[model samples]
Target: MMFEYMDKMVMFQDTPEGLTADMGWLKEAGENGWELVSSVPLIAPNRDGIAYGTVGCQMILKRPKPTQ
Candidate 1:
């Protein structure tokens, strides 16, 4: 079940302060059992000065326990 859901899942990348998402999508994802795993921030220096990037959260969800 988890694998099936994950296969149909989609990933999104958003630039820092570039675009925003509506609350409805977040709520729907949560309701469908999507869990947040991690989030990261990216930074880079451009000709202007500095630029910021956002690596949105990641989620690893499984039905059966993951084996090590």
Candidate 2:
């Protein structure tokens, strides 16, 4: 049988501040059956510090059983 699942895409800034917010949201979603699938920093570093970019977080979750 093909089970149903849920997917969510979260985006955040490359800065610490942005990460903080993103983490909080991710945590809440995880509690609801959201499993982290993949993540990547959107910043492309050059000779300087972090380049202008954002971070992307992806998560997958299995559907909860229906309450009958």
Candidate 3:
């Protein structure tokens, strides 16, 4: 069997609405058969070298390869 993979960079504001939008996007992807495999935070360290919040995330998805 073969599979296809996708890597998406999702960004949103640090607010309730932003989070809700993100979840909605994820749910849409799920409905289309994109299985969530991993999610990695994309954060920038502050001047003090401490990471507090994430600006976005990298999502990894996979699905069965389609055949003709």
Candidate 4:
């Protein structure tokens, strides 16, 4: 089987709007035949070289490749 992943999901500090926005993307992905596999929050060091915790998120989804 073959599949594809979409990592463009976004979240703004895990706010309510951010949650809803990501949910919207997830919903759209399902409509396009993708099944959610995982969702992970992303964090990175700031300019001061310190992690401020979850700053964003990444979503993993996959579905069978279309017949060719």
Per-residue lDDT tens digits for candidate 1, residues 1-68, read 22323422223446597744344554566677665444343344578876755433334432333455
Rank by lDDT, highest first. 3, 4, 2, 1
Better of 2 and 3 by TM-score: 3
* RMSD of candidate 4 to true structure, Å: 3.0
lDDT of 4 by residue, 1-68 (tens): 88876666576644665533445766787899989788898787889989977767787888888879
In TM-score terms, candidate 1 sits at 0.35
Candidate 2 deviation (Cα RMSD): 5.5
Candidates in descending TM-score order: 3, 4, 2, 1
Query: Evaluated with lDDT, which candidate comes out highest?
Result: 3
The residue-by-residue lDDT of candidate 2 on 22-65, one tens digit each, is 46766777676656655545444567785755556455666455
Which lDDT values do the candidates have, in the order given?
0.45, 0.58, 0.82, 0.74
Model 4 has an lDDT value of 0.74
- Writing each residue's lDDT as its tens digit, candidate 3 over 1-68 gives 78899999888565755552256777888898899999998887899999967778899999888987
Identify the superior model by TM-score, candidate 1 or candidate 2.
2
Query: How well does candidate 4 score on lDDT at residue 62?
Result: 83
Can you tell me which runs of candidate 3 are displaced by over 4 Å?
A: 16-21, 47-52
